[model samples]
Target: MSLDTQSPGLLAEPQAVQATADGGTRLALRGDLLDFTHQPEWGAIESDAVRFREDHWLLIEDGRIVGAQPGSLAPDASWTRHDHRGRLILPGFIDTHVHSPQLDVIASHGTELLDWLNTYTFPAEKRYANLVEAETGAARFADALLAHGTTSAVVFPTVHKVSADALFAAARERGMRLITGKVLMDRHSPDGLRDEAPDFGARDCVDLIDRWHGVDRLAYAVTVRFAPTSSPGQLAMAGQLCTSMPGLYMQTHLAENRAEVKWVHELFPDARSYLDVYERAGLLNARAVFAHGIWLDDDDRALLRDSRAQIAHSPSSNLFLGSGLFNWRAADEANVRVSIATDVGGGTSLSLQRTIADAYKVQALQGERLTAWRGLHAATLGAAAGLSLNEEIGSLSEGCTADVCVWDWTQGSVAQRRHELARNLHERVFAWLTLSDERNLVTAYVRGIARYER
Candidate 1:
């Protein structure tokens, strides 16, 4: 076997079943279908603000939701039926920011952002140089995401080109929509992790983009580790790649930590702020996603808003690293798109439910409350919009992909109690978001295929 196929056990094997022929495939999912038509803001009451259809049925054919309606009957007798009685069916979670190589080091104690990267993150990521090891890590990481009900993600693979290939390969085999790139860092990182030269880094990114961008469900991103890790030449190449490639995504860190922010300012004294580093590099655009935007000032926020750039709010990672609270409300007020994320390794959990819980707490600390509807929307439709992927995987709307999660609201004790006393949909959803984890996921589907089942 080739190196990439040597460790197949590292991935969670799906059940032995053949996919039904494309046109002949029709699967009917019956449950309480929950979908968001728009970003749901907090309110004293819950109405049709967020759409939830009890006793609903969705028709799936060729991996897309052909039709969805509030009824119990399938339109045709040839359809396969999945009867999720009493469970809640919602759009699968979309995590906009996560590091696949750092799954092993998740929850590791560290001093701060820069120190954390030098001490634990870089050392761990450097191991992905081995194609076999990278494949194994990618498989495990992808499985972990499925187990936690994430059907799509914007990922950061290691600087190793093989790392990006391995991750995109595994995600392709499972039909998961993953957007990632070969990390472009030409300075300040360890010897093994940093690119040898600026042109070499740019060439690797271009090659990876050629090999994987727009292939299958995989899309390419131009990833600079951050402002401090990339030299000006490397950043310019990354920006050039972003502008040259159509539909290409640009992802990197922003004002995640105070020290990191100060370092960026010191490193690029000509720039106005940390955001300006990428802005001046011509990397700010609607397709760009900056992670952990916790320390942005008004000017920075305005720049982001003006550029139509997006932010991946990694509340769990921010809290774990003692990074300052993100002013998501301010971003929203400024019309800057913000989506929830699990910045793994630096972040403690892969589960979006846990991230949502952390986000609730984080926003609470800022005296800004996020409703359960809004929080769920952030991980689903809101995140999809942030990543410029709304038409594909974020909702239960007809013609959308069948990436969905079935939640057993009566499973855990807290959920059971909520099920008993819950008079409204909002109350039950709030309880579940606050109290649920991976255990609450009865099953998770990606493109109409069952990848994880409890």
Candidate 2:
């Protein structure tokens, strides 16, 4: 299942893959293993929701986790060992919503969502029309995600077909589990960046899907740039593709800001709410992921729950753009699937740690505390489950792909002191989450093969 046989593209770095007598790779990671078994309750962390094996050896054969043994392996063991004793070995982070071409626009000043997109995001993405620019950016962006401990992601590429092609090519070279598609926006966008014609955009998407979807670890998303930018015909075209193409994913923004919500209401007066616009287009389904979703009403949530669609909680982006706080508890109560993401560029980082730290603060502003378990789950297993890829990418359990990251218990001296003073696993993990970032990541592995190192 590994893409290691393919020639390294722009970003592949050399890493050893152990060869066993069976003519397959075998390896083990020795560390403090942790992953969520299920979704945890709100406001407080539950012990049962977590699976923690202290100082365990996570066994891997070929590209999947075979078992997790609690002690050292036999002295004559033939497997290659990457000893990360005293560190945390967990599933690689999964980012549900992020823009790949916006890597250069991160940290740019902006007034709000629309303004930000015009001033920074659009210009950066416009560059992707060039094949060289698209390939170079995609390669650097994929490398950056792994460097930040993200092994799997649902991405947003530019409106150019070349953008999605370049991104998939880069991901294939690195064996990353990546999903993206050419963005569709036929109106309200700049001349060079807009699709210009809905039918042409749909045709491009079809061609890209035939070429890339389900190849290696890559998948295609039917990316709509929100209802305002897409006409009724364009949205219908996107919906048609979803129905025709089984297992295809759909991603778009939904009520991310109050103004954006109001704009949706004005644009689609017949629709009940912002989500209703997409619903009427037949775009609501289990594979659909709407970003932000900060302003959805109870009725909208009920619709999402019924549709089995998901909301991607992008805390950093919300705070940066003055988007409202996400009602994590409310969405969960309504049985709506929710996952955490970096929403990069609009978000301040590619680091999920920053996103999770901001998530805690956002929930706190709403008079709720985000447990480390809840935050960790949202980024790891929960995100994977949202994409219906949990059985493959989100856990260290047997039969799951071996996409993993090793993290130090603490980073700076102050963070180390806090961890040392903690009285329990909960406190230690909270401190680690608050204080850690990509710098704390010792290494990241995709399919039991090391891909990034500090």
- Clashing pairs for model 1 are none
Each model's lDDT: 0.85, 0.89
Residues 1-454 of candidate 2: C-alpha lDDT, one tens digit per residue: 2332232222255466678888998888889999988888876655698899999888889989999887565313578887888899989999999999988888888579988888888888889999999998998889889889999999998999999999999889889999999999988889887776636488899999999999999999999989999998899999999999999999999999888888888889999999999998989999999999999889999999998889999999999999889999899899999899999988999999889999999999989899999999999999899999989988988999999999999877899889989998989888888889988888888988788776
Model 1 residue 127 CA deviation in Å: 0.7
What would the TM-scores of all predictions be?
0.94, 0.96
Candidate 1 residue-wise lDDT, 401-421, digit = tens: 989888887665656877789
* Consecutive 10-residue window with the lowest summed lDDT within model 1: 1-10
Those runs of model 1 whose alpha carbons end farther than 4 Å from true positions after fitting are 1-23, 42-48, 74-76, 198-200
